[model samples]
Target: MGEAIGQTIPLGVGVALSPLPVVAVVLMLGSRRGRSNGPAFLIGWLLGLVVVGSVALLVAGALGPTDEGEPAAWVSWVKLALGVLALLLAGRTWRDRPTGGHRPELPSWMRTVDGFTAGKALGLGAGLSGVNPKNLMLTLAAGAVIAQTGIPAGEQAVALGVFVLIGALGPGVPVVGYLALGERAERMLGELQTWMVRHNAAIMTVVVLVIGAKLIGDAVAGLAA
Candidate 1:
């Protein structure tokens, strides 16, 4: 258990950093949602999470049962520990996040997303978040974590659903936070947008560095075990 727990530190780290494109899209939404549009950015982000999470659950259910082979007890513990570690890494990012900076901008394609349908926000978020390989990676990672834990099939599906929900949160939480802090984001975006072009490289380097460390750490931890 202790060994497995130790290994998850890296797994969680990887999960924490895997949603760049989605995150970028959420960022581009920025203060534009509520202040600029009608609702808060959180509304859209939360919508996206709900959509992605639902699809992910369906995918997990379809995955249908944990693998037959049993892993060492240590692996399970590592997965459990990885969950905790992922949370910790998230905290580290929260603490280290720039004192004042808007969410990062994304490619022009993301701007076209419109959450006005009957499915509205969730559909938009899902379409963007769904087809991404990151979702597949996390779903697979959830299987690893569950299989290692020796959970039964039904339970494994449930566990995968939950982990994927948390994974979706990588994008969900930030937009919510930014939306709640819309005024702050607006101010920060204002200031940063002015000089962001010059600092974009450095800022991105830091974001990538942090996320890369998380992913690489998890990969190594899984392999090491």
Candidate 2:
């Protein structure tokens, strides 16, 4: 059980930390109004990630395995694939030069901001993953990992619920990590508007392929060991 649980963590992280959620946060938060709504946006961004992990738990629990093989090869592949994906994504993001992809850019005007509502911002932030294909694929992969572990659906659900809350923290650490950045950073991301349109598509595609390779790579390495 411990080994199974241990194995699931990377899968969960892979699913949780993909660029879709991060991009959504960056995109929506990059909006002109997003700077003013920083607090709300942050809250919502986190809630949205929670929704994603929750989905993973629910799906994994729902599709409980009836028969299974300890496919160490597959698992190792998954790890390698995930790692490659991360590197690919990092490369793309770096290529696009978003500075801080997970964090948004704030505009000069919104720098010294006024009152902002957390509720509305949260609403938009929650929608970050709504149309994101990356989020869907990542979440499904995680669900597969969870269901394959032989844990009861109920327990898997619980674990995923917890993971989402924790997972969001990984990408969102900056929101809390740097206070001076605040809304300004979120708005400035808009500077990438032109760049995102021109380069983000290819970057995103590379991220997907790379992560898949990483997953497969990890699986193979484990099998070798």
Candidate 3:
């Protein structure tokens, strides 16, 4: 469990520290129906993550038994694949970066989010957490790591639950603050949103590159050991 957690921390952080989701949630908090939609969005977001992670874990478990002592070769291969995907995604993110000192445009749907029903908000949350390429891959990678760790099923579930909670924290903090501090958080969240919009690409570039290398390196080390 400890090993799994260590390996998954970055993936969790990557999912949690994503700026756009937080920005969108914060924007929702400013809407008239924020009270219902914000929490609903959060629940939906967490459910999406849990669903992906759980599926990966289940699949990994179903792959049959392996040598008890040595790590499975497929685990390393999976990590390598995930690493390559991350690098490719990093390149794409770098390319999509807004040139010059301009904010990246928010999606057209975001403009209308303020009026969204709870159902729409929930759908949006699911789309961002489950369907977004970056988050989906990270969650899968994290799940694969846990599943491959040779831990008991019960422990694996605990680790996965922890991963989901940590990954949700980044997007969850704003909602907590909004509920607690009310309007006071608006200005801070707004500033954060602006900075995130401006630097999101660059930030993701570093994150994906570093974590990608780590995954590849860890996989290679496990295979060699």
Candidate 4:
């Protein structure tokens, strides 16, 4: 459980650093209905993660009882595939990384964010967490790590819970700050948004590469044994 949790922390951090979701939450906070929309989005985000993690755990458990007190061989292969996917994503991220102080472009839908209500915001948040390409893959990878562990179901759930909370931190901080500090959060959130846009790709490249290599090594060891 400990090793599996350790493996997922980086993945959680990577998910947190995702700029699109953070930016969306920030923009929602800047709107008139922010009080409702922000929290709703956050709730949706957490729920989406919970659903994904739960599904992964159920599937892993249903595959059959294990005698080795560890994940079956197939889980390692899934991890290996995930690792290769991560490396490919990292390469793409590196190539597309912003340069010369330029920031990445925001999604077109972001232009209409202020017009969104709580329900739409909730759906958006859920989609970003469970459907967005980068976040979806990372969350699934985290789920895979948790599912592969030989820990009890309760412990697996706890590990996944921790991953979701940590993963949501990047998007949650701004909302919390805005609620706590009121007017003072704007400048901070803005600066954070800018910084995230500038550094997101670089951070993802390093994180994905390291996690990818680690997954490959773990898979090799598992298969060899």
Candidate 5:
């Protein structure tokens, strides 16, 4: 379990630091129905992470992710593939970064956040956390890492729970603050949102590149072993 946690911490951080979701949550918090929508979105985000991570763990377990206390070849292969995909995503993000003082464009759905029902917020949260390419890949990789450790099922659940908790911190922190600090949080969160939006592409590029390199390194080490 310790080994699995160590292996997955970076991947979990990758998911937790995702800028867009944080921005979305901030937007929701500032909306008319913020009191309902904020927590609803958070719940959906947590559910999405749990579902995706559980599925990856189950699939990897079925594939016999470990052999003789070492990762099976397939685990390394999957890591390699995921690493390559991350690099490609990094390149794309870099290409799309705003330049020459132009403002970055957020997703069109973000504009509709002000009018969203709790249900719509929930669905949007799920889609962003589970379906976004970068987050999905990181969560999948974290689950695969946990599975490759050959821990008992209970330990795997604990490790995944830890991952989810960490991942939730991205949006969770703001929501908690909004609930606790009420309007006091608005200014701080607004500043944070602006900074995140302006630097989103650069942040993603660096983060995805680092994780991609790490995954590839782990894969190579496993393969070499």
Candidate 6:
């Protein structure tokens, strides 16, 4: 269990620091219906991570992810593939980064956040956490790492729970602050949102690249062993 948790920390951190989700949650907290939408969005984000991580664990388990205390051959291959995918995504993100003096704009859908119902916020949270390419890959890699440890199912659950908790931190911090500090959090969250928006591409590129390199290293080590 410790080993599994160790392996997943980096991946979980990658998910937790995802900029768009943090920005979205900050937007929700500043919205007209913030009181309702903020918490709903947080719940949805957590559920999304849980769902994706659970599915990956199930699939890895089915595939017999470990053999004789090492990752199974196919498991290593899957990690290699995921690592390569992450690198490709990092390249794309880096290429798309705002250049020169051009300002980065939030997506069109985000403009409507001020009027979103709680359900819509919830769904958006889920989509960003579970369906976004970078986040999905990181969560899947964490799941595979947990499964590859060959821990008992219960231990695997614990490790995954830890991963989910860590992954929730990015959006969770703002929601918690809002609940505790009310309007006092507005200024801080707004500042955070602006910075995140400005550097979203750079942050994603670096995080994805680091995780990609780590996954590839792990894969290579597993293959060599």
Q: Write the per-residue lDDT of candidate 2 for residues 27-102, one digit (tens) a residue.
A: 4454555444554656765566556656655655464544554433444454565556555665665575544444
Report the C-alpha displacement of residue 71, candidate 5, in angstroms: 1.4
How far out, in Å, is residue 207 in model 4? 2.7
User: Which residue ranges in model 4 land beyond 4 Å of their true spot?
Assistant: 1-4
Best by the lDDT measure = 5
Q: TM-score of predicted model 5?
A: 0.98
**Order of candidates by TM-score, top first?**
5, 6, 3, 4, 2, 1
| Model 5 weakest 10-residue run by lDDT | 62-71
Tell me, by TM-score, which candidate is best: 5
How do the residues 1-225 of candidate 3 rate in per-residue lDDT, one tens digit apiece? Answer: 898888888889888878789878988988999888988889889999999999989887777337774457887888888888888999998998888777788878779978999998888888899878888988988888888888899999999988899989977898888888888988998888888878888988988888788878877886786
Question: Weakest 10 consecutive residues, lDDT, candidate 3?
Answer: 63-72
Candidate 1: tens digits of C-alpha lDDT, residues 1-225: 333233334333334444443344344545234333222333443344444444544553444433654454444344444444444544564565454655545456445544333234444454444444433333344445444555455664455445544545554554555558866665554444445433544543454345445544655565565
TM-score for candidate 1: 0.46
User: Residue by residue across 81-187, what tens digits does model 5's lDDT show?
Assistant: 99999999999999979899999999998999999999999998898889999989999999888988888999999999999998899999999999999999999
- Listed per candidate, the RMSD to the true structure in angstroms reads 8.9, 7.6, 1.3, 1.9, 0.9, 1.1
- Name the regions of candidate 1 deviating beyond 4 angstroms: 1-12, 22-28, 35-69, 72-106, 114-120, 152-162, 189-225
Which regions in candidate 5 have their CA more than 4 angstroms from the true location? none
Worst 10 residues of 4 by lDDT: 61-70
Candidate 6 weakest lDDT stretch, 10 residues? 62-71
Lowest summed lDDT window (length 10), candidate 2: 107-116
- In order, candidate lDDTs are 0.45, 0.52, 0.85, 0.81, 0.93, 0.90
Pairs clashing within candidate 6: none
Off by over 4 Å in 2: 1-36, 67-117, 152-158, 165-171, 180-206, 214-225
RMSD of 3: 1.3
For model 6 the TM-score comes to 0.97
Between candidates 3 and 6, the one scoring higher on lDDT is 6
